[model samples]
Target chain A: GPKVLQIPSHQIIDMGQMVTLNCDPVSNHLYFYWYKQILGQQMEFLVNFYNGKVMEKSKLFKDQFSVERPDGSYFTLKIQPTALEDSAVYFCASSLEAGGSDYTFGSGTRLLVI
Target chain B: GDKVKQSPSALSLQEGTNSALRCNFSIAATTVQWFLQNPRGSLINLFYLVPGTKENGRLKSAFDSKESYSTLHIRDAQLEDSGTYFCAAPSNSAGNKLTFGIGTRVLVRP
Candidate 1:
């Protein structure tokens, strides 16, 4: 069974600070994705990355948000100048291929901005 | 328009009862996956279907690509099955992007 692991299960940060969320995808997975869920809302897709580049991103992925797969070690999502609205549960998911594949998700990292 | 919509926002069942949860997709979904989010907030994959039915333990799920809908049936529900269930659909044109339903909260009481 494949599993995705996310670090810093819970994070608290002040507004305007920079926060980085790390994800260690399955070793054999080729596609990684980030999803966000506000309290009481459905999960929304943020972005997807593959081949060390961003494949697609939703409108919720703002300019302050960035993702990278540096050194093929960990896929990370960084948010600079975080806003209060950014407070939500961030989930990291990975799949073997681009489409029609079941994705494995981590337990998620809860981010709080004050 | 919501790409995915789930029915019965919340449900409560007595132990040993049976229930069904559903998801309707507005998009041309090529694949469907169901997940259960437990009280600990851990999302566990239940079923992944492509226009077919799959059964595991007391859970059964079916997806119909032509109708763009999916159903999850729980036979003889237990307290451990109490959680939020979500169905996600990836559109044929979206390229690996999944749109999730708002989720159905189920509470099973003894």
Candidate 2:
């Protein structure tokens, strides 16, 4: 089975600080995605990246959030000046292709902003 | 409005019993995917469906694009099956972003 690895399984950060989450997607996967799940709520899509560019993003992807995968390295999501509402489990997923392709998800990085 | 809605927000099932989880979609979804989030918060991909049915070992899943719904059936449930089951559909035709359901929490009791 393919695996997406997320670094820092749990993180506690102060509000207004910058935090970056790292995701090591499957080596052969080309499409990457980020999802946010608040405790006791449904998971929401943040954004999707392909070919080093953001393809699509949802309203939940605030202006303070950004994503990049430099030189095919670990895909990273950075949030600058984070807010308390940003505290949630972030799950990263990757797929070989888009359009009905199966996705492999990471265990998730639980970020707690205090 | 909820785009992807799941039934029976929580369920308690006895081991070796069978249970079925369902998801009704409000968006125009061409495909459906089921995932099981374990206690450790791992989203394990269970099934990727394309308006059809698929079975793997003790689990079975079906997606009806015309009906805008999907179903996941767990047969002869085991303790390991206790988890939060979620069904998701792509937000766009490219299938890039996924909209997930609230999830059905299943607690398998011995």
Candidate 3:
């Protein structure tokens, strides 16, 4: 019954601009993650965060991308100088623990970079 | 190499039919999770298993950690069951970072 809430269900931005996606994870959840799914493609891991630090990030997590859960509040994924390839549906998810548990995913934010 | 591979990239089934989808993991996966993506692009969690079987309603899922594979069975399929099914595997060393399969798109005809 845990839920993750994603803000701005959809976003359209110009290339080379910056975009910030927000996610409010379950109140007591300890782990947070970001995944991206391009149209007609599989969901790919972007990054995972815990204890105020990034635990792991996949190759797809570009250098211009950053994630933070400042002040134990909402988790955010910021992309600077967004590129065309950044256009996709970004999903935020959280789990009570780091491993072997069901993750609650937000509906997702559809990002379209022109 | 794909860490997780799902079979039958797409399937069409008639109502009341039974079908099974599968995922094979190339990595050392310790846990698996199944999800269904609806027409509106919402990811709905279906099952989470660790080396065993779980059944709920008309759906059943099984994961074998030793063999690194998982299966999802749908019985008495209905039109509402049409969607993209994805299976995710978390590496034993990655601390729950999921590697997803390409997904199987299923369409149930009435």
Candidate 4:
């Protein structure tokens, strides 16, 4: 099972601060996705990136949220001026193709905004 | 307006027993994926399907495109199986983003 590695299992930041979550998707995988799950709630889609550009994003992906993979580096999600409702576990996933095959997910980073 | 609906929001199962969870989609879902979130909060991929069936050990899954639904069956359920199970489908036309169901929490009892 190929693994998608997420850095900093847990992060605590102030409500109006910016925080970046890093994800190391499986090597050779083309599609990358980010999902957010609040405590005891459904995991919602944030955004999906491919070819160094955003493919599609959900309404949940706010204007303040952005994702990028600089120079083929780690795919990262940055939330600026985080809100209280932004506190949740962020899961990173990757797929080798768009055919619903070889989708691997990271352990997730639990972000807490105080 | 819920695109994906999962039934049995919660269930309690006895170890070694069998049970099935289901997902009915209102949107056009060509592919379905099942994931299990353990107590440690790790989302583990269980099955991925495209209008077909797949089996792995005690877990079996099937997706029906014409019916717009998917199913996950657990045989010989174990205590470790106690967790939240989620079924997700890629956006009908986008094929990139996933729309997940609310999830079903299963508790395996000894």
Candidate 1 clashing pairs, residues 3+ apart or interchain: none
lDDT of 2 by residue, B21-66 (tens): 9999999999899999998888889999898999999999999999
Candidate 3: tens digits of C-alpha lDDT, residues A6-102: 9999999999999999999999988899999999799999999989999999899999999999998889999998999999999999988887476
On a 0 to 100 scale, what is the lDDT of residue B27 in model 4?
87
Residue A64, model 2: Cα distance from true site in angstroms: 0.7
**Weakest lDDT window of 10 consecutive positions for candidate 2 chain A:** A95-104
Indicate the residue-level lDDT of B93 in model 3.
81
lDDT of 1 at A36: 98
Model 3, B1-110: lDDT tens digits are 99999998999999999999999999988889999999999999999888999999999999998988999999999999999999998864855788899999999999
Model 1 chain B scores worst on lDDT over the 10 consecutive residues at: B89-98
lDDT for each residue of candidate 4 in B1-110, tens digit (9 for 90 to 100): 88999988999999999999999999888899899999999989898798889999999999999999999999999999999999988874757678899999999999
Q: Regarding TM-score, does 2 or 4 come out ahead?
A: 2
As for candidate 4, its clashing pairs are: none
Q: Estimate, for each residue in A1-114, the C-alpha lDDT of model 2 and write its tens digit.
A: 768999989999999999999999999999999999999678999999999999999999999999999999999999999999999999999999895456899999999999
Superior by DockQ: candidate 2 or candidate 3: 2
| C-alpha TM-score for every candidate | 0.97, 0.97, 0.97, 0.96
| CAPRI category for model 4 | medium
Determine the TM-score of chain B of model 3.
0.96
Q: What share of the true interface contacts does each candidate keep?
A: 0.79, 0.87, 0.71, 0.76
lDDT of 3 at A30: 89
